[model samples]
Target: MTALPPVVDEQTWRDALADLLVREKAATKELDAIAAARRRLPAVKLPEYRLTAEDGSSVTLAEVFDGRSQLVIYHHMWSDGNRWQCSGCTGLTSQWTRTGALAELDARFVVVTNGPMDEILAYKKRVGNEMTWYSSAGSAFGADMDAGPGEGFAFNVFLRDGDDVYRTWHTTSRGAEQFSLFFAISDVLPYGRQEVWQDVPDGWPQDPTYERWLTSKDVAALYGDPEA
Candidate 1:
């Protein structure tokens, strides 16, 4: 059995929480400053590249913005002929099933994978995913952006100026975790995700990192709520 946090008097708990709140507020302020700095980061002009659309149509990188000025792409990992998809990427994509809110900010989010269009659509339907997905098949867009076929995942931001496109920022691995609500919520829990890497109290349950991630199908089966 996992050990629980030590019980304390109500007043003592409140006092401890108050102290933690101060640090939490400071962290929030620091994050705000970081975001401000990111806004000032310079972007690089990208060469013209063609990408495959959902219907197997060819589209320019600039056209991907869909008339929006800013574009966010999650470079979803894909391996040809592999029946099992990357569960981590699948879970991450699931978090953004609906992106209408981001559209209001003049930004569009989509998934770009190196897999073939037919297979991509099949998996999208099987997983009941709603976010717009595109394929980088037969294009250098994935490799130039550091998310080549069979490579790991990446999150990229782009700025579209008229017909021109520029790469603003990109991050992968742990950097993408900030966009996950699961991690944010787990951080406040008692066992704290039950992950071995976490600095938790002795006797607390801990398993291999990422072993707790739930695929879209798992969610649907467990909760009876499939996005499709």
Candidate 2:
């Protein structure tokens, strides 16, 4: 039988791991370049539509941008009646950071959904997100963006010049695998709490999935006890 190679010492093992990480970083840079290229492509024009804000205020697509040159609408998966407060949409929102500097870039980001303004407000409050949210409760905007029921996950960007709005780009991928600050940190840290029930080191409890984290009314009650 052939003999196996000798086991490496701790120092050698650490050096090998560091080399692998360097290569991974280089590969990640390539991925970022590709995403940048996609962003640089021309925008596509979407039809005009109206949506409602949480305060019951109605606004058209042009109005939503507040006269900005670009608009990014996250077609949240909230639907009328029974399908309100979609988990996937909630997950995406949870990962978003408020773009306070968006105005400087001539861009506005908003969440569009089929749920009523009240429902959207409730979900936003529950998730503690401060980003602007709106509802397309009575409109086909969601469907037009391919975010309607039974439609695949997607997000689209639009650019406005004069009175014309054009579609810029869109994307949909496995939620958990998407490269965000959360995932980047999780990939390096020994414990990255994502998608509740993710396994952790011994003595650490599995984190609750994002779905349960958002919908569970007793979340505070269950995890609230500081002494526990």
Q: Write the per-residue lDDT of candidate 1 for residues 43-119, one digit (tens) a residue.
A: 99999999999988999999999999999999999988665578788777777766888889999999999999998
Q: Please count the clashing residue pairs in each candidate, in the order shown.
A: 0, 9
| Candidate 2 lDDT by residue in tens digits, 92-116 | 5666766868889999987777678
**lDDT of each model, Cα atoms only?**
0.87, 0.67
- All candidates: TM-score: 0.93, 0.72
Model 2 residue 185 CA deviation (Å) reads 2.2
lDDT of 2 at 205: 37
Local lDDT at 42 for model 1 = 94
Rate residue 228 of model 1 by lDDT.
37
